[model samples]
Target: MQRSKLVSQILEKKNYLCVGLDTDTEKLPAHLKNKPDGIFEFNKRIIDATLEHCVSYKINTAFYESMGTKGWEIMQETFNYIPDSHFKIADAKRGDIGNTSHQYAIAFYETLKADAVTVAPYMGEDSIKPFLSYKDKWAIVLGLTSNAGSKDFQQLILSDTGKPLYETVLETVAKWGNIDNTMFVTGATKADFFEDIRSVVPEHFLLVPGVGAQGGSLSEVSKKGANKDIGLLINASRAIIYASGGEDFDLAASEAAKEICNEMKGYIV
Candidate 1:
């Protein structure tokens, strides 16, 4: 989907919520465990239930990849099942040498047809450029993440520039692609850094994880991270999808998602 369409969806729905489909069979309700295609079934219900309240869905490939071929098939089916109006994301942090990155790009962009894919930028421009070559697709680069380990490298000050590595990453990468095509992954846990981050890439969208289950504050993120276009896709996974362990999992999931969406609406102009 084009960036304009995504912005319109956010405005029209009065939401910037991205539901993470990190479906785990072991954690699924016991009732669904015995059912055939439980993974897809759970995802279908989650999609159907929360579609109205969310603007995007992020599928973390690891959950599906662990299940092997069956998981891969369900992942494709779930991707296809999502409505075109809602943005679909492949939360596969893929980045490698240029040639390998090319195949990875084709796998997610062409074969699976995801609107966006999470990419690790450790390999530099060659690894990232291949994904950017595709039209209307996005490479959500890992910037300052929410993980505790981010302190090891991303927060380190650069030798010459003296700015943090993550800050440099945002400044340097912003020149490679315009805001419409390239986005940065700034974890919600790093809410305090949003001010500095905005100073660099003020217009580009940010895919923010670490909310909900991770205990990141929504209001803090909205205040620090939002741009004039409401440029933030706040994602919630275990908090919403696994809201309940009973048969009413879908309903509970929808309720959890709606609550976040409502909170998000307050952030929107």
Candidate 2:
């Protein structure tokens, strides 16, 4: 997925919504839970229902990885099911030393064929550089995450820089890769910091989680986080995918996604 193609899709769709397939097997519709391929079935339905409303789909690997080999197969199948017209992301949050990170990159970018993979940056440039080596693939580094625990470290003001650690992260990490292959994960819950985030990397795309189920205000993020290309992949997982727990789950998911997409249309300008 080229940066230009992603922006073109966003503009054409009038929404930057990135539906997250954070499909929890325990939370699947009662009817589908007992089936052999229930997880993939759920994902297939969700992808089919919401295809028109979003420009991307983020498949959170944790949910699948927990299922072991079967889960990995399902994850790969789900990735294959997604249309190439939309950006596909593997939310693995993986990072390690150089050689290890290369393997992680291969797992997500090569094996799973995802357009992007979410990565942790605690290990510094070596941990993140491998993911950026692929031409059009992206490494979505954690900037200021939506999780509450993010406060413990990301917000700490550095003695040398006189700026929050996340700010320093944004400044330094932005230099490691160009906008085409680099993006930052700034949680929608951390909406307050979006303005400051943009000040450092205005042109890079942002993978924004915590929007729907996490209670982050979409409007606030849109107003503060959007770039010239509307560079925000606003992800709504449980809110949309698990909208209903019955036979009508697909329809419910479609409506849920459509509603968010509609709200997004208003913020596009």
lDDT string, candidate 2, 72-189, tens digits: 9999999999999999999999999999999999999999999999999899999999999999999999999999999999999999989999989888989999999999999999
TM-scores for the candidates:
0.99, 0.99
In model 2, the clashing pairs are: none
Error of 1 at 268 (Å): 1.1
Misplaced by over 4 Å in model 1 are none
- Model 1 per-residue lDDT tens digits across residues 1-269: 89999998999899999999999999989989978888899999999999988999999999999999999999999999998998999999999999999999999999999999999988888889888988899999999998999999999999999899999889888888888789999999989999999999999999999997777899999999999999999999999999999999999999999999999888887
List the candidate 2 regions with Cα displacement exceeding 4 Å. none
Candidate 1, 188: how far from true, in Å?
A: 0.5
Each model's C-alpha lDDT? 0.93, 0.94
Clashing pairs in 1: none
